[model samples]
Target chain A: MIEGIATLATLGFTLGLFLALAARFLKVEADPIVDDITAMLPGSNCGQCGFAGCGQAAEAMAEGTATLDICPPGGKGLIENLAARLGVDWDFSNSTTNTVPMLAYVQEATCIGCTRCFKACPTDAIIGAPKQMHSVIDSACNGCTLCIDVCPTECLQMVEVKTTLTNWRWNKPLPLAQLPLAA
Target chain B: MPKLSIRGGVHPDEHKLTNEITITRVPTPERLYLPLKQHIGAPAAPDKVIHEIIHKGQIIARAQGSVSANIHAPCSGYVEQITDWAAPHPSGLPTRTMVLVNDGRELRDDVSTPVNPLFLRPEVIAERVSQAGIVGLGGATFPSAVKLTLGQSRNTPVLIINGCECEPYLTCDDRLMQERTQAVMDGIQLLAQALYGPDTIIAIERNKPEAIRLMEIACKDFGNIRVMAVPTRYPMGSEKQLIEYITGRQVPAGKLSADIGVTLHNISTAYAISNAVRHGKPLTHRIVTVAGDAVKRPGNYEVPIGMLISDLLAFCGLKEEPQRILMGGPMMGQALPHAEIPITKGCNGVLAMSRAEVKNSTEHPCIRCASCVDACPIGLSPLTMAAMLKKDKLDQAVDIGLKDCILCGSCSFACPSAIPLVHYFNYGKGELLIRGQQQQKDDEIKRLIQGRQVRMAQQEKEKEEMIAKRMQAIAKRKAAEKAAAEQNSEKEIA
Candidate 1:
């Protein structure tokens, strides 16, 4: 019993010592600000920000290599939030206008049943079997246009979708305008 | 009378001015614009040809899907146009509408022969109801045929007739019950028969003693039916609340009343069914309450479907240029930008309120008072939901039961700070739907990208295998040529 306990203790101490050494040698000192910026960004990983993903974009921003208005999906909200979090002064004039939300539509007549665009779509918005005319599921399309370049028939087109009554909302009326005016 | 009460409701001021007035049939208008999407679900497809002369009660639009209802012509007229116009929705978006011009003949098509509803099978009754385009006249406008089918399928044990006209300034249902009690009761009996002899209960609020007396006397002839006067409460007419009050059964959240072996129909819907089944007449008109302080003459009018609100308001005689014109009751009605919009199957009231009656209060921040919690009939936290929505944390708001909200204005009315709680919920629901759709798109894009990668890798593997096979073939041919050359040299040396 004594020998077994001793061997186990030795093994545990040795493994713990090795883990401590490895951790010290391979430690990645992640900047807290980078994490905070990443948290502020839309985690879509759409690569529209010219980075591999939102994490890389956040890292570049922390290193002062990337600007605040890099994410298209984040829009003005992310820029404002990120600027506040990073304590940086951002130029609104340099910021690009937010792109209108769009969905991809496939022209069925010219689709050629290639299935090339279907494979390239980042979202499985396209539905069809091999050698069959493919159609885009409008609700599932992010308008990333990833399928546009891959389509041999050039049948994929992006269209802007307007908000319908199902998604329409009443903006809060101005408070002063609603109050009765003194005659 | 034993009175039933529900949890978490508000008693708004009952400004029912037309409660004592009888229903009057208004003269047909010159033009009627009927939006195809009069009811919930898919909009009906226009079946009549443009410029064709259509007789009254002719099918103008057929139901596009199972969840939709047919739309019949209200008066004999020529189809002027089928175009888009501002619909009677809160968003005021343009929807496809069929405009008919009255030829002034007031001609109606010959209806089917009247038959005893009791002699007909439940399926036949349901089919007849569907053909007549009868819908729930209590603001929901769900096709009554669908409900009947569902009740029959579930073998529901109880049928609740909603006579609780609880909305402020809306007395159409109350007046309907008082004037056509026997018709309404007949409708209830027919619906019960369709639902396989379910116990029928007509629930009316205590505020309308006249309607209760009439309904009770009318129901006495039916052995299985009972008329119960429930306590006066705002939104007691809601399907969930009514089901609970009548049967002491709570319809589980995100479920229908039929799921719990109970079916509820509006009193007006029952009355419409009686007319449709007994006389073989289609639903061409409805009783609309035109009441408010701004009206010179406030009373219920039996107005034809597709009549413009402006014509209805003019017929009622407006006392002044109304500050606000709302379709349906004030609590849950949509304010029309102009009076040009037409009435549909769902419209129960046309309230033209004076400036004094409209409380355009300056909205104040919520002080964290729990009055909204007490007023919410569905038992949801409006304050927390509003706060989460303001922060744009929709998932968190949904986690706190945002989907359970019925958009009742009770919380908004009870809030002392005037937070506009219902507006926030509406906005939140809309935003959630948009975001959910976007997320679905993102997921689909990811899947497509993954599929592309898999396909490319497969192609690359196939190309590598072809190249490997070609190289092997080339090597084998070269070795054979070398062997042949060596054999010739050996033979020449010999």
Candidate 2:
């Protein structure tokens, strides 16, 4: 019985060694970019990029299949992170460049008081019901511009809310100013 | 009740009253202000001379690159002024613009059939689209040609048409479906032909039964295409959401719909495609929904691109001075500083609101009600993210999955506290980006400084070595000279 046990252990060890050797021989070169791109991402599986999750987004980024500006919910932060990590330049101006933060508003009176739009909103930004005036959840709007297209009463509109000092953040400067800001 | 969601999104009240009256084209304004940069990507450089007489559909601005869209004269008019003006920007900053004084001729002289896209290759089709200034009229304003190219290169299997106008107070698309059904479908057919054969699907919200019925009927004859009614949801009209909802497949982040063998085009874009292809017309005008509580006459108008918001409001018979003038739908729209800004390709709706509608509710602290979380379609904790962002700990926010946020406004909409959670995210994102840029610059500088120091040290070492070798050679020569002198003296003595 002891001899049989020894034989079994030997067989297991031999099989393990063979598997390890096969793995080494079959190794395909992995693109190191996957790790870099993954690190750049928010790591949240929000599926905001139309993907299944953030990990999938990272994979796509490594594959060069998606644009760096694909994340709308991530907004400018994601774009900047991606640009920095990928060593790419990105224009972020609002007039002609990407990364302008936008909000959504609903036309209240014209809303027909139907909850169709409320139901259609993925973010539940609209608050009202059938036979009641609907209002926009202004703070939560992602500015994806999806909701503006579906209103039966033509009540939904994507108006850019004015960016005041209350909501303003200092813009990122050109690369010449490499020093970190004083906290 | 817990609201349903599928992906990144927000719900805003759809104030569509301004457009609910009926469809009417505002009488041509005395002057039309056309912005040189109307579409997405780079703005086209003005090609025409400052005062050169231009007609409708005349290419005033040509596409500069693959990402840029073209710009055309909306009506026959003379360039009155070419100057910078406050555009409809969140920052309320002025941008370069072109103002035109309308001759009220409504002239469209430059009309002719271009090379038929059907007979031409896909590449030719793309070129014509580029020339037509065609963009995704669905508010994205992305160049149609680029989308087409992306689809062709990746061999996208299915084309999804977005018909989910879920935002409140905007019914331009809905009306377009109701009124221009045939034109829209024709546009869809052209898009399909341009893309992968006729394997197309029209994704309409179940709420728009009429639109669904019309689209279904229109597409019935086209065996390769069909209409699909997605469950009505805010941001359901989003490309990612619609794609996932329809195909049950999620397009990975950092990837495109084409990567998953799918491509999406707006119904309006399809219409533009048809207009550009069949009518041989450049994208000069589109259907805009003018809606709000303040306007006496509200409805959809086939307004030309670059028309001012003031003219539109006046033409509609201003019932009251609006408290807010918004471009696009309320949920995802932007509030205009005033009505001076001209319309662009991405403008789909204009809303005028009374003081009452614009009044802000008193904001309160969060009660930990978990309402925002419940309302979030992508299933995110808005309260936590907002708190982290408030503390200026963007990295921690990111650690909590900040990248996954869709900014759909559901949380804010559901928040009883009236906290601008989405705005906070935007702020946090902006701050984070600034920090990232600074970090990148620092790293680059460090690399350069290190390289310079290393080179300087190497040069110093080389100089010292050269001096030492020279001194040694000189000493050897002196010693040889002394030896030779001594030998000469000895010879003389002998």
Candidate 3:
């Protein structure tokens, strides 16, 4: 029993020393997950997720401090993806954030030839000359609200995306509980 | 070649109510709402301004892209308006539609005289077919011209005509085969020649012995054409399934039958092609089986493309308020919200079912009986896929052959639990599509953002450079002015 214990102790000591050396000498400088998350993110750096940027948001997400759904721009797909990656059982069906996709609409009539909104736009969705009324390209606008805050004229507003034949999809089937009882 | 049997299938009660009924005709309605996107690919685009008059057989909207069909006026009518209107879909959403008001006179324009299509070259025939805007009437709605071109390009060795109206409560194809045998045969012969004299087989379901008999009689003179009576199984009419049953071959996933040196066309499509080539007729009308218990007159009707379902039902007469109204066959048909939807080129059946006909069972949890597995014609695991979907693992489900699903509804029909397996699949497919669209939008946004970032940086750099250049020029001008002033002052001092 003494010999067995001595041999085990020696092996443990040697292994522990090797692990310590490896930890010290071969330590990773950055979390690989942060980079992966940054790649998946919108990369717009719109700061709508309450973080300084997507990189910071990814850092917080990696550290488990930020929920996957914290970024509105990422949408439900991102949440599900992140949940899957992190091995979390995210019940997306019951999620309250069934937010209708919003598009930045420009109130052209009220807009005073201010280039501030365009300057703040991350996607260059706004188009106009410096002193001319600006218009947002519906397709390109990310609805980040950065332009909204910077808009001195308050011309930019988030409008729910109107359903067109191209963009519209079949409504999801109602759950059994939600389905009305047969007459 | 070894026979690749149908992977999985279900035997639903073949409610061939209108199988023996002769084809009938319905009068033109007051207003016909024709949708732009009746066929697959890009929707037919109208170049006319609002209120423009369109005559019968006039090309109101031309096919925009390679894989599209032209939309012709079924009746001489003035354009009422082009606006979003109800579509014959389950979603009940409005799509871009051209409303035409019938003037009671069907004045056709540019009616071409008959030319023997057999004398024409294959490419010429293809051009005429594309101009006629004929699509597969087998509910697939693939552009017939495009399919012909594909067959020609692939050097197809066999041509299989799909006469299997395997869907329950739909007998439009059967009726067409029984009535228009010669035209369909001519179409088959013409198609065979266009496809470089490929061996032709008209595959009809054994259930429709009449269609089979008629087709066989018509194929007597054609040495290459043969009428085949295949098993009357559900989805036996599917191009892949029919090819498998007759040719003993399997069309690889993500590939057409042409890839395997074969081409398949529907019976209705063949008839349409015959009409288009012989009479120079555009695809403006189709035989629709208006059946089910609720319909007063359960028979097949040759319906105008833009005619409203309400008008058709008014002519047929409904016995009572239908519990469910479907635009196609009951098995794979869409449950339409109302009867205001207009008929399209692809629609084959208009079923107004009662509660008894529609066996709406309470959805029960899967019993893990694997009935769904047995019923899937594509041999996909509907149960396991559903489980993955429940876990929100859509990508995982896709990995396990979700893309091959044909939405045949055989699994749901086979399920004893009435679990609505097809509904789950529909949901999954829609979710995947939506997710794909979202991914595309995200990618587009990312590109735009990156481009904007680069542009902003370039603009800033340019602005800085412009400012520095202006400052240098101002300083140089000031130095030159000072030198001139100093020279003038020195002159005065001298």
Candidate 4:
């Protein structure tokens, strides 16, 4: 029985040693980054980001190749993740500090016959062509700055178009509002 | 009155006269300018050089990454020039487009190469989807490959196909379900096979009875797949809302649908998948609903990717003049000042309304009507959030569930006073993110400052100690010299 136990112990130790050696030899120098980047993400995978997807974006973020603020859809969740992953300080004060949802508007009178803005918009939010008045295709527009930079006649404007009844949301009032006694 | 909703939301006349009509195909244009960026994600990059001969479904541009969708040649044509031009965007931005001058033959090349996707691994299927440039054609344009990967990793148990074309005046999905029901069902079957036979459910709003019937019949043989009708409500097509209505699951804010063992894909996306899998075709042309009050002939037509809105309007027989052209439905669609914009994959409808149809009521202050409160699907207070955003109190707004606002435009649509409530929520959300980013930066700077001060103080202490030691050594040397001089003088006197 003792001999049998010894043999078993020897086999277990041998297997453990082999595993340790293999682990050392085959150690993938995974950019200690991919996991770090994954943690920083909002993890919604909403695809508002332009990467192949959030996983691809996370991989890119880990590799230190992709921009930190590329995800406008993930917005702050994305920014925070990127900041944590890179261990860098983020200064959004000058970088469009307010996250006010921007909408595309056109100065109908100023629009020239050129269709510059239509081609520039990433979401195909604008509709118009050469020698004609241009318009904004609202539903597909994500308010990316690609369209604003493409207008030749400066006809397209990124206006904080007021959210009307058609777009307004009903936010739950604070606890104080529900209690007339408190007021 | 079936619990008539109150608060914020505009009842743009449904104008769904064209909803029941069948989809028609538009003839090839003289020159088709295809934009690389169509979806909400990363813009695609062109693979072909200037003046390259390209066939239909030949991917003109490749999706940059998982977030980006692929771009394909809409027709068999010679590439003219890869130039930057104004695209169909509200920003009136110039984007890189592959200009293809049609040869006028309208001859479609056989780019469809069948692949036995059934035998391949789920990861392999996802890789093929990525290569095919598939995306959510539901206007979000999220890459399909990434979604599949998420489902694979998370062990998704169900696949919910969104056939609920809830937006008024949009009937593209309805037409797709009616005309291509089998294809959609086939795509779902393939998706199920990829996910180890997860139950597939097609969720259609009750209003689209024809679509529900067609989809149900198509999936009759597949016991795992079923068709369920949800309430006919606005934004019933939203990813979160649809999941809740069908499965009683609410995908938490900042979490994916896979987290709840559910995978949601749009109906058009399923059809695209079928085309890619069976026909070996990449996404090129899509069904677009061209309807509004001003058009003489309002109908749904299958259009190429880069056709001008003007051509589509003319084909529909434009009335005297349109007051505005909006892409998508009236409630959530963006307004186009001109009709020069090119349609992309996400574009579902082209609305040209007469001035009479678009006389939006003037904006008024919220009267605390509590109508918006009732309209909120997520149970948010739109007015409070808007007010906080107005005061630049972003943190306060966030505390009140600003993150939950889906921006479905339902609250805004429900508002009688024409208040832009959704705009405020969007603004608040954006501001909260910006402030959080700023705080992160400030914290980083503060740490750097503290580290530098500690180092500087240590260096000062070291310098002072060195100086003190040197002074003590010099005093010792002087004392030794004085003692030697005094001893020498005493010897000379003796």
Candidate whose TM-score is highest: 3
TM-score per candidate, in order? Answer: 0.78, 0.66, 0.92, 0.65
Per-residue alpha-carbon lDDT of candidate 3 for residues A1-183, written as tens digits (9 for 90 to 100) = 999999999999999999999999999899888898897888888887889999999999999998777777778777867887777877765776644677888898898878888888888888888778889898787667788888887888988888765666655445545556479
lDDT of 3 by residue, B1-494 (tens): 42444668877898897888889988888998999998889988986668998888888888988988998888887998999999777876898899999998888877764568888788877888898889889998889999999988988999988888889889998988888888888888778878888999888878998888888888899888998877768888877777887878788989878888888898888888888888888888999999888989989999999898889988999898889999998889999989999999999999999878778688776789999998888888999987776666788889988888888999888988787777777778887887888888888999988888888889999999999999999999999999999999999999
Clashing pairs in 1: A122-B445, A122-B446, A123-B444, A123-B445, A123-B446, A124-B444, A124-B445, A140-B441
Tens digits of per-residue lDDT for model 1 on A95-162?
A: 67554566678898888888887666655678888889999887666666668778887788877777
Top candidate on lDDT is 3
Q: With candidate 4 superimposed using the best TM-score fit, by how many Å does residue B471's alpha carbon deviate from the native?
A: 26
Candidate 3 deviant stretches above 4 angstroms = A1-28, A85-87, A93-99, A129-133, A170-183, B1-5
B1-494: candidate 2 lDDT, tens digit per residue: 11244754545554544433455766667777777676677878887877889887888877787699778887887887778777766665666678877888878875766555566566767777888888887777888899998988887888989988877877888888887898898788777777758378887777778788888888888899898787666878877777777788877765778899998999888888878887888887888988778988788998887888988887887888898988877766877788988888889898898888785965566789988888876667989998876655577788876777766677878788787787787676777655665355334433543454576689999999999999989998999999999999999988
> Per-residue alpha-carbon lDDT of model 4 for B309-403, expressed as tens digits?
88888888988699889988776777775887788788899999888887676676578987888788788888888887775556567788888
| Whole-structure CA lDDT of model 2 | 0.74
- Tally clashing residue pairs in candidate 1: 8
Error of 3 at B36 (Å): 0.4
Candidate rank order under DockQ: 3, 1, 2, 4
Q: List the global CA lDDT of all models.
A: 0.84, 0.74, 0.85, 0.75
Residue range A31-62, candidate 4, lDDT tens digits? 65776665455343435457655578888766
